[model samples]
Target chain A: MSAAEDRLPPLRRSSGSVGRIALIVLGIVLALLLLVAPLAVIFAEAFSKGVAYYARNIVQADTLHAIWLTVLTAIVVVPVNIGFGIAAAWAVTKFRFPGKKLLIALIELPFSVSPIVAGVIYILLYGANGLLGPLLADHDIRLMFAVPGIFLVSLFVTSPFVAREIIPLMQSQGSDDEEAATSLGAGFWQTFFRVTLPNIKWALLYGAVLCNARVMGEFGAVSVVSGNVRGETNTLPLHIELLYHDYNAVGAFAAATTLTVLALVTLGIKTLIEAKGGGDPHRPRH
Target chain B: MAGALTARRVLPGFGPTMGLTLFYLSLVVLLPIVALALKTGEIGLARYLDIITGPRVLASFRVTVTAALLATAINAGIGLLLAWNLVRYDFPGKRLLDALIDLPFALPTAVAGIALTALFAPNGWFGAPLAAMGIKIAYTPLGIAIAMAFTSLPFVVRTVQPVLEDVRPEVEEAAASRGARAWQIFRKVIFPTILPAFIAGCTLAFARCLGEFGAVIFIAGNLPEQTEIAALLIFIRLEEYDYPAAAAIASTVLVAALVVLLLANWLQARSQRHSEKTP
Candidate 1:
């Protein structure tokens, strides 16, 4: 089979070199324009006002706070998602039971939700006129237009990444390893940590990387719940908006450059992990 | 052993883990959706109908749906071309090209919006050149489509790339040996293989475009009846404190999403079955 495949080569290999060259040129140019130029523009604009100005604006208290908030949100959100991802993946994959498919489908609903709709839904559930609004008010509690609200909305949008990555892999791997470990007298946690977790580590990291990228970039729902509280709830993306609106183009683009780097790092890690996974790596999503 | 375990739920913590998953899923996802449904319910059926049928809401829906459809269609073709190039050819920066395709997923939508708006604005890079030709982009519905197209292009490319990679050369050689033309081989052999991924990717792109807010808002000009998207209309209603109106629009989009989600699920299942049949 391998020898026959080698003999055949690929159809494209036999095509005219001129046609191939033209297609390659077009592909490269399009990719550069659509994918690469955006990063260049953000950096160019950021440093247009000079590096000192860009650096100064980036460290401004509110801008720093926005950066901090973005990181903090991801920090909290990623782990919770990691935990939920683990639990859900375990429940559905390791234990095949009634309603298993339904459970999997429901976990995916968060991905289907429009971020703005997530915010709107939260508002209906927690706004002053909402279902639990009165109850929250009675206790002098707040969840909307606050840090907690931002976190919750971020949680809703990002909860799916980790579980979606791990579950399918675990399902395909089956429970043989775990069953083997159990037979060998390992405790449940021991079997899980040694056998299951080690095997799925790359997928877990892959999912976490995507999750971190998203939680940081999340703008739509965060905008609704954040209320654009400068030095407060404004995450990096929202802060970039605030700067742009205030005509601080340099500041806005500078903040945007930071986010661009974050995205680049995420893409880097994602690529590296996928490379490590070697075989057909399961494609993770945004 | 496998049969015995399957028969009796041999796994430990099934109850606890399952409970936590259900509770979290319900609280984080299902409840909010349920609350939106309930909120829309209070507005009597006539008022509910009236809210969605309002001039502003109607206009927003048209812009959103039309722009999304156009974007998905555009991405479907371009994304396939890009994927085909990446998989079938050897080129420098090929890895970079592949990595960069995922930028849309990684980059913040707001950043994407501004980058696109800046690039297409009159004073911006591509904008200045296009302006000489009287081609306006930013602050236009065309700009909205571009942003939607940018954010969604990855879906089609990623989905189709793997399928393309898995298409063995031997399969194509068989057709070639039959004296088939390149185009015919592509149509008969290549196209059918990738069609399912293309459909799957297009659906995701369409669904995503429908909800796209940050990227679209920056470029769309938000010209209420002309350029505003459905998601923006929901945000606007909340800003105006018109809860019922927002919920009404939300109801329409949610219903649409559920349908699309269902369709996507069915497509995925069908594709899985197709692959198993052949492989």
Candidate 2:
């Protein structure tokens, strides 16, 4: 038995059989309990009230408005963020500049800041009692407690995704393609559209998908600035909170079901992108 | 030569792209941060100290920190196990399991909060069994920790997975051939290689948990002096039109987050150095 064990290659060398089984079982149980159960519960509770009830909740005016608002936010936010991301990636990757590291860190600052703090800073800047409050009030302009406030905070929260995704990718790939195209007498737009864009397209999509998902599901920051009007300013995540608070479990879960599906689709797209050899969107390139 | 080559701009869009990046970064991020600083400064040092040190606020900080620490501890262990399993074992549904690790990141925090609450509430699925044993999860700090753990679970697993995968099997094979015990090999070899990433991941997860609001509030029960978190207190202060108070508390959290981010970056740099030296 000892000789046979020695004859086995190191890769085939087993830890104690009982220990291996125990570790696997523990891993599976933790994943199932911590990660999988919450997901299963969302679908289960969403449909707990039957298809008619779930469907009715889904199309309710408030729910529809919330969904619409979330879509509007995503629609406006994702494109702007994508533009910012591309620009930041371009500057950071292609040029040597002073304060580049600081710039990258600043771009990543929002990811570290609490979303609620994100909401508060904006309110301090633009709320009715804020620094610009009097100036805005004179002109009847509202940024906080309005759609624009929601947009601003959402922008702050998801600002890093696109740039963070593409920067490392662009850095690793180097500026060779862009430089080559430029040296070949290609204009900026032509090189970007034909060369730089193709190389970073998947990463850009990955970033955009993540950005859109966060915008739709954003709760902490949006909750602060939205003013929580039921059918008016509420986004999907806010709508779910409203329903849950009102003891409308079915309604809340139904709304949650929509966001959950969005989350799943985002994950699916992310996995597909990874399979297509898009760089891992989150890791720093060593 | 390399520095000179890099110094010469090779791309024409630098002027346009760099201009846009700075302009947007300022308008969206820096200006608000400056506004926050101004608000906090206007509140004066005494008032800022008083508000942040009030009993309720302090209590909430304790709860937030304690729960976050607990959650980070849980994540480090489970995340390591899962990362190790995924990298080493040939299990059925491995691909699916790998995908599931990121569910926390992709799912909305509010959705996660409610779903976790439903599962762990006393009358709910997991809660019922545990309740029969006289232990409660939801509506307690334990619940808050669970929410934190759920939201931050991917940090450790994702951070450690690549490092573990990079641990050449040949090294392990050599050790095994030399009759090193499995535990000894792991402790002496694999553990050192993955330590920096693991610690960095935990720090990040801890930082994230400290600021976690949406996923935590639903399950936290939001009781003052017991279950309330610092982030919710900031919201409460804001709701009451106490802008100065909210700003003060938020400043503290913000400073802590920045400190944590700096630490994480340093650790990551160190990890990179370690990998480079070893390779």
DockQ of each: 0.67, 0.64
Best by lDDT: 2
- Local lDDT at B229 for model 2: 98
Error of 2 at B76 (Å): 0.8
Prediction 2 TM-score vs. true: 0.96
Worst 10 residues of 2 chain A by lDDT: A7-16
Question: For all candidates listed, what's the TM-score of chain B alone?
Answer: 0.94, 0.96
Judging by DockQ against the true structure, name the best candidate.
1
Least accurate stretch of 10 residues (summed lDDT) in model 1 chain A? A277-286
TM-score of each: 0.96, 0.96
Question: Residues B25-123, candidate 2, lDDT per residue (tens digit)?
Answer: 999999999999999999999999999899999999999999999999999999899988888776668788898889998899999999999999999
Alpha-carbon deviation at A106 in model 2, angstroms = 0.8
DockQ of 1: 0.67
